[model samples]
Target: MQLTGMFVHPLKSTRGIAFERAFAGKLGLLHDREWLLVTPDGDQITARSHPQLVRVRVELLPGGILLHYEGKPPIFAMTTVFTRPHRAQVWKDVFQAWHGDQRLDAWFAAILGQECRLLWLGAQSGRALKGGGEKMSFADGYPFLLVNQASLDDLNSQLAQPVTLRHFRPNLVVNGDYPWMEDEWQVIRIGEVEFDVMKPCARCVLTTVNPDSGEKNPDGEPLRTLVRTRRLEEGVCFGINLKARNEGMLQLGAPLEILEQRYSF
Candidate 1:
């Protein structure tokens, strides 16, 4: 197997940026999910609910991020050193996270036509993994999400319209020989980083939204087909959640070494 793609979503739910090389840290990729849009009460505003969010594109800048939307001027939100802790929530995991620039918040509020604030997870995340010890950013659950290209191809064969890897929002995409081969992988190494395959990623309606147009597929395609084909004990799964065992640089075309695999059923 080989590593084929690397991606990072600086702002949760917005368009993601593809990378040829990225640093694998404890909290997944370097700038992935560091920024998020939330309500005044701290609930996450994702593309799952607000499809318009997918229209916003984010560029990771040196000290901050650049936001781009159609017909609007690109906005730059600088990251300031935050000392105060503000309460925020991602799913059911409520924790103290830092708020971003007020100007950025206003920009988002006007775009979404709803009351919301932009938050930064700080230089280091305060949210701990469910079991404890390791910390994660604003990702739904695990630190990293891995998708197999072959698996997607298999799903496309059943679909009327094909979707790219962006729809699922994975940090890493590997080229494997067979479909769903990742299901049996327990441990794998990419470049200098080794990751523990944690669990099958339970997909959601967000996959039904077009990453480019931000419109829902009226047919409810891949997700609908996955329900019939890929449903496991844990929801409809299209990818695997991963936790980095060690930190290092991950480059495209890196060889994927399987250190361990699950026993055959």
Candidate 2:
């Protein structure tokens, strides 16, 4: 199969930046989830709790980022270097992170209507990957998430109104012939980078949100359907989480070569 799509999420829960190619490192993609929104307690925030986050359009700058949303003035948050560092928490993992400017923090506070701060997970990150060994950005669990287009197509065929790939928020989307072929892939290589298909990614309520509007599915759809078909002991699983074994440049349309296959089922 071929790699058809590539994306980077600079900030957690915000819009993803589509790219033709990206540098892959320990964190999967460079600048991916390097910054994040967190409470004063360092707890991470997401569209699952605050759906408005998806409404924020993010454009990566030469240094910082440009954030745009409806009915609000655009704001630019600089990442030159965080002066005030804070303990940032994602799930149960906590690490030292730099807090953004009050203006940037206030921007998010005003938009979310809560006292939230933006934290940067730069090269100084200390949090270990879920299964141990190596560090990562503020990405949910693993360094990368992969989905097959054919699998999404299969899912769309079963839905009344198909959901977009944005809802699933995958980092790498591959073009494959059969549905759910990724379930059996243990290792895959795109260009020069090799990734271990760590485990099945547990789907969440965030998938029900409309990526364009930040509105949730009123009927509790995709999640409900996935529960009926893709449910696992962990949760409703759709995509696969990945950890890069080697760093390199990943380009779209590159052939996805599987080195090993072992089904969890």
Candidate 3:
């Protein structure tokens, strides 16, 4: 098995940027989900609710980020070097994050047609994993979410219209021997980083949103299909959540070594 793709979402819930190589931090891929969108009251807003957010393309820049949307000039938001710590929420985790200035707020509000604030996770994060000691950023739950290409291919073969990895929003994509082969993996090393296979990632309505158009599928595909085929006690499942045991650089085509297998194949 080998690493086939890597991606990072500088801003949570927006389009992700594919990379040939990425720095894996203890928290997550560098710059992955470092920024988040929230209601003025600190409630998180994601593509699951605001589907149009998927239309916003975020390009990470050295100092900050560039936001691109149709019919509008690209908006550049520089990283806030200094700011008062603002409180925000992601699921049940509430912690202090930095506000990205008023200019950025206005631009995002105009694009999304809703009042919202952008929060930065800051250089040091305070939210620790639920049962583990490692820190994490604004990702849904785990630091990394990995998907198998063969698994997606298998899912595609069952669908009338195929879905892409964009819908699943994985941080890493690997190709291995067969479909769902990653399910049995307990610990795996990609490039120089080793990750613990955390749990099966549950699928949600977000998977029904088209990354390109930001439109919810009228037919409710992949998600519906998953419910029929991959449903578990935890709801429909698709990918596996992972947490890195160590930090290093991950590159495309790096051999994936399964260090431990906890389940019988």
List the candidate numbers ranked by lDDT, top first: 1, 3, 2
Query: So what's the TM-score on candidate 2?
Result: 0.97
| Worst lDDT 10-window in candidate 1 | 77-86
The CA lDDT at 43 in model 3 is 80
Q: Candidate 2, which segments miss by more than 4 Å at Cα?
A: 263-265
Cand. 2 Cα-lDDT: 0.88
**Each model's number of backbone clashes?**
0, 0, 0
lDDT of 3 by residue, 1-265 (tens): 8999999998998999999999998888999998899999888889998898899999888888889989888988777652767888999998888885887888889977899998888889868777977788999999999999999999999999999999999999999789988888999999889999988999899999999999999999988889999987666899899998888999999999999997765
Positional deviation of residue 64's Cα in model 3 after best superposition, in angstroms: 0.8
* Regions of candidate 3 where Cα sits further than 4 Å from its true position: none
Q: Evaluate candidate 2 by giving its C-alpha RMSD to the native, one decimal.
A: 1.5
lDDT of 1 by residue, 15-41 (tens): 989999899998999999998889998
Candidate 1's C-alpha lDDT?
0.90
TM-score per candidate: 0.97, 0.97, 0.97
Single out the weakest 10-residue window by summed lDDT for candidate 2. Answer: 122-131
- lDDT for residue 72 in candidate 3, whole number 0-100: 81
lDDT of 3 at 220: 95
Clashing pairs in 2: none
- Model 3, position 70: C-alpha lDDT score: 92
